[model samples]
Target: MKPSGGSAPGGLFSRLTGFPAGTGGDGVAALSKRQWTRLTAAHQVRAVVAHRWAVVVLALLGAAGAGAVTLAQTPVYSSTVQLVLTANYPAKDIDQVSRGSNYVLQRINTYATIANNSGVAKAVIDKLGLPYSGEQLMANVTVTTHAGSTAMEISVRDTSAQRASDIANAYGAEFPAFVGKLETPDYVDTAPIRVSVTTPATVPAAPVSPDPVANVALGLLAGLGCGLVLAAVRYARVRTVRDERHATEITGLSLLGAPAVDRAAPLLGADRAATPAAEAFRQIRTNARLRAAGQRLTSIAVVGSVPGDDAAAVAANLALTWARAGDTVVLIDGDFRDPSLPGLFGVPNGTGLADMLSAGTPANHALQQVQPELQLFLLAPGTPMPGSAERLLRTNELTKLMESFRRDGAFVVLLAPPLLANADTLVLLSATDAVAATTRVGFTHSDRLAAALQVLQAIRANVLGIVATRP
Candidate 1:
């Protein structure tokens, strides 16, 4: 029996989600709260980074949209004029001149605010005969005083560059007169303080708003941020079985090995030349031997979820590899629905597995040699028994066949039907000693693989590992 919960490798997510251990009832692993949280974050981030094309496309579209919006906005121009404040009081000494300069500097800040006031706005607007009122003109006007100096600046912004310059110069010309009248006494003809324009406003050749390069850059940044968020969301929702890592993580199965797709690789190991698929099969055979050393695993079932998962290829190559290593191996085509062993090895499927099981045919007469010199044997599906295939597998005939193969000192490798395709292979699970699942890279879905694992767990089958077919 599986334990309730601990630090066991298999039940990591199921514990947190209240699902049974080693089952995909809730589509979650049997993990503790902390472990589940950590795995979720890491897995989601990995998925997002794995599919970066979606993120790039979204980012590009976001940047293009922002650039289009920036181009649609109206451009604005700003013009500025500078003024200097000076005290007219006659100074007799150097100390008096210093004191007068300090007074002028202190009054500059006050003059800056007064320059943008409604009174100055009305005066400037009336002199220029502008269409706007005092309040409206004041809305576009701004005044700033330089630090530790008697200099003040008046700025105006408008859609037209000439209008912006006219408004700025008008404020500069009117503020000095407005200050002079306000500061002068009732009987005095002259004022103690005066303001003079240092730099006149000029019409700007370029607009300040709607900078194309800056806007496009900002849009790119925003778009990239949005794309990463979208990628993370997509990764969290969709679960696709892409490689061995995902297969092992979701199914709690060991990673046997990944075999490369090489059409030049033959079914039997008669060709001594080393190929990627051959080397991979040799390694998988070693792993299976190590796994079975502790248990009595004589009958091995190689199953897949889909038709193109290469389960038959894995079983045939693995049997040949073991036979080449001086072990007597028998490869059985257990999938009567879609028998592939005869076609794969170019053998006649006249007198094989179905005949041996149904007619009490002797194994010596039914088994076909993969090659005359090799100890590898083939038990291909003899004939199509579509209606009674599941019943034949469910009976004691399969168990007796395995017993007979075990007595002959032959390791049996069965290529069963796909788990999702039909339930014919599910009937043979009772007699199978160990199981290995095969999945095609970038083709199988995680949900179907999880369901297959759940069925294996339900039947209490010994899970050897998983074989990933690299495209």
Candidate 2:
């Protein structure tokens, strides 16, 4: 039968065929920039969510560090004194009052500068008998003015609340006298402008610096940002397949199914009929059947994209799934390098595929019946033929054996080694009617999977789809 396209099934097999007919380039390269960005951002968010505990831990560390620094800092108390500049000449009319207000507003900035001057700081330091120098006292002084008003504010910070209040009040008292001396000009008795105290400085009840709450909050924000950046970098640097979508994108094949990892029961045994792993294998069987609707798919080569993908278990379960449905299934351990089906099924490793290809052993004599109730048979990798396994598989005996199984209406499931691990896998795949590629989530590197798919495509092998096993 010839390979033909059909309507895709719903759910796991809904994704379109990724690779084009001739080109082996990126399957998602056709997407627009905006769509690609959204897709990448979605993956990044998922990665961050997967490592949320790390982010939380980093944020807490940052907050604790900020809180510690805040505690170690010296406490500083702040005090402010308010002053107003007014016209010394009595205003006779509304226009005169408006002119006086404008003049004060124009000079308010100058007065604010004078309030923060080193001379004023020196005078305040001398009057209060403080130990600080003029430059040191001026560093802690701040002056501000109100726009369109005749108000100026003088603030001072110090380790002692009383000293801060004294410094601010001293500026309020001495600034007017200093202005008077400068403005009187030795011609008039009083200065043209008068500076009067509007609000006297008060001792602060609490220190303004070393705010623990604000510091911790800022630190938490900064830490959270840093955590997100690190998470994104880690996600970008990761080379393994993240999920089923990632597997599909890499292999450019429809996702057959993902079997949940069950450490307690790795194989789908007869006692574990109702388990999710069994159901997943059954789903994979169904999808494989649907994918090969028009073609003859009696023999399937289960090949892993990379090492440790557990392709042997996938092949065993898949064969068991088909046999449980009343179909005669022959499970062959095609991987002579590392034969696992004998240990998996508790069958003795005797004369099997190796003997059949080299010594021309009868297929029926080499086949072992694993399940008595079900029509399931196992062909163990008989004898350790290390160097000649590839040469044996290249012979036509393998093809004839598969044909004999197909002729008997039995489904042959061959457990082949990883594509990148052994060269015999290509020979096994060529003998089989179809191939079922397996990948382990978070274990199979995407680039390795792509390379395997390219090799399969180069040989024009019939790949059914991908089966992702999640741990």
Candidate 3:
């Protein structure tokens, strides 16, 4: 089978990212700084795309904010008046008009700046009776001349359209008098340079700001960018096992099977149901049995790191699978704190493992026939005894019971307590021939799985493999 992200489409990207040859895109291997950065970025993008609802929500929120800001702002209206700055003189021939035109062109730039002078602004303000000083009026006015053109444009912006038009027209009318005074200090009938208004200032039809569509678009882009960043951060900091790939990478154990996440379904294989969950249990059973034969295993113990995991369910279903295959099988509920074998098989919980241990009763006395047609049996934990359960599990009677089951040509499966929750599972380590860990993806933290594996290895338990539940 080809490794994940190892196909031609992703080969170049995987090499640049330094992903291992036989590992998947979601590998948890420790990587170099550059590789980590690239992989982390890629993972973040994938995470965001996989969860599209986040993007929609963020975009909507951003759009709403931008729209609100645009609406809350004050609307402004602008008016512009064009003036033709021509040389004014009585020309006898074309040569005189050409020379005068050149002279006026040289002074056009000076006139553009002069139009914004404090004196010119004050004159316009007084002429229009505006409610502002020369400096305040200057803030609302602008003057410009197009390149290689003798036309000058003066503009005024205000909240009121009428006021903007009045201010613009005042500047156009007053500028000519100001220029005349500068050119000829003495009173004269005509001036060398004259300014004339070609296009008079008119009230604007609409406001120039607060464009709804543009604001919303910008906001949506900003929100989506923020959502992408958040998704990346969440993926980078995740510590739980997300899938079977993550579990195998962290534990370095063969992945036997991944049972479906179903809270409503009954114990798989109990009724010989041909469901995905049941098939998963059968696969796990086959893998475990193969490993057991090579290691000369007689009794197998199924355990987890924490309570509420599907460890007991896996053990029970595995025993049923073997029994269905015409092999004698017995499931032992070793978890005294929370025994589920009696409830799962619908047998009386009275007089079971605890009873067998108190008295030197035969192991079969407590064993209940789960399926008469098939060679399947169950040993319930009976009652809750959290205090002495660990001590009771470590007794010599447990070893004797395992040997008795093996002699009867029946394979034993112990649904042991969570390894981290109690020491009962460790007690079964010496008696059981093989151990299998059950884990729930997303719910199981990588640290918890690692710690459980460390304890099993420290005790020299023959760990067959790991079975991921609800992958």
Candidate 4:
């Protein structure tokens, strides 16, 4: 392993495969067909539960509104006259024209006309003191003939049912005299449409114009239609990345072992309550050992493309893991601007690398032994350090530190600041043997990622690949 100047792909595996593949490609997410199915299924359920109820309520309201609108319209009343055709043969007959049902049928229409004649209607109007004309009366009335029968019925409608019925019966009573005037008079109407005094209209218990129940039903149907429409619209607009297969499509990355929600799995969530930074450390620890083929000891520096990576947390845990394997592992927090390892490990933040570089503090005093196996060296960013910290890796002291780790066969994992945000991490990479890049899932943008990856390629960094972190 050597210092990567501009990120490059080189590992024992890359060499053996003879096809050096970088960790990234042209940023594009191709949605899979199967994922589309899952997305629609979830979306359909959500749409039904959310919008269907609203559609129902809207339907009900629409029905009520329609009923009210109808109620506001003027009412129309109707009356019907049922005339029973009596066999009133006038006892004068003696011809073929007078005996057949056709003759009787032909004569019945005359009765329908006689039933609605101006002479009879006017007399009834005069008797009843009506306001409308006989012609108007006839206009409001319909005389319909029953099929294959010698009978016809007349119905009239107005704003008042009682008045309609009264007019009908009065005009009906006047029909007998008018029939006598007709040359072809045949029969008499014995019955007519009339209202019972006992059932006089009293503003009607229920309205005659609008039916609320039916209106409600119609509204509900309309609401149902609307709900379905909205549901379909939402169904078509769904997107998802709910599983590992989808994650692959979005990132164009290989399926490295995913951390199961269960932290207690073989190499998963060993610390359930741990921060995201700590989780990355565990993943990298597994990746370097199990993912790599050989048993050779490796020193991988953790770097991210942006700050607030909690990279120091990862270094601390990773170093602990190596030390647990009976190797003395030193975790170095190299971020001079915002040192975090000291606070993360509950160690003293005062008198660290910064103190040593500026105040001549001994390395032994600045070094904090967290465990018999693990040691943490918090980088102190004092006045002299911040100004020349980018060149800190160039010092003889840093070279001595690397040599000491090599001699003891102890692993040294340095936590570097993000290269994209600060120059400290990229500069420190020159001193590191390999780079373990941490990329935050769903946070890092593609353009910035392409730039960072390009740097690693330029630096020829021993690209140990990536650690995908979920916070």
Global lDDT of each candidate:
0.77, 0.80, 0.76, 0.56
For all candidates, the clash counts are: 9, 0, 0, 17
Q: What is the model-wide C-alpha lDDT for candidate 3?
A: 0.76
Cα lDDT for residue 466, candidate 3: 93
- Candidate 2 structure quality by residue, lDDT tens digits, 304-326: 86668878789988989999999
**TM-score of every candidate relative to the true structure:** 0.80, 0.84, 0.69, 0.46
Query: Using lDDT as the measure, what is the rank order of every candidate, best first?
Result: 2, 1, 3, 4
Instruction: Provide the global lDDT of candidate 2 against the true structure.
Output: 0.80
* Candidate 4 regions with alpha-carbon error over 4 angstroms: 1-283, 294-297, 350-363, 372-383, 395-400, 441-451
CA lDDT of 182 in candidate 2?
A: 69
Question: Which TM-score value belongs to model 1?
Answer: 0.80
For model 2, the stretches where C-alpha displacement exceeds 4 angstroms are: 1-57, 223-239, 384-387
Question: Deviation in angstroms for 409 in model 1?
Answer: 2.7
RMSD of each: 6.5, 7.5, 10.6, 11.5
- Model 3: how far residue 288 lies from native, Å: 5.1
- Sorted by TM-score (best first), the order is 2, 1, 3, 4
Candidate 1 C-alpha lDDT tens digits along 378-463: 99888746566645665678788999899989998888877655556665656678888888766666765776676677657787
Itemize residue pairs with steric clashes in candidate 2.
Answer: none
* TM-score winner: 2
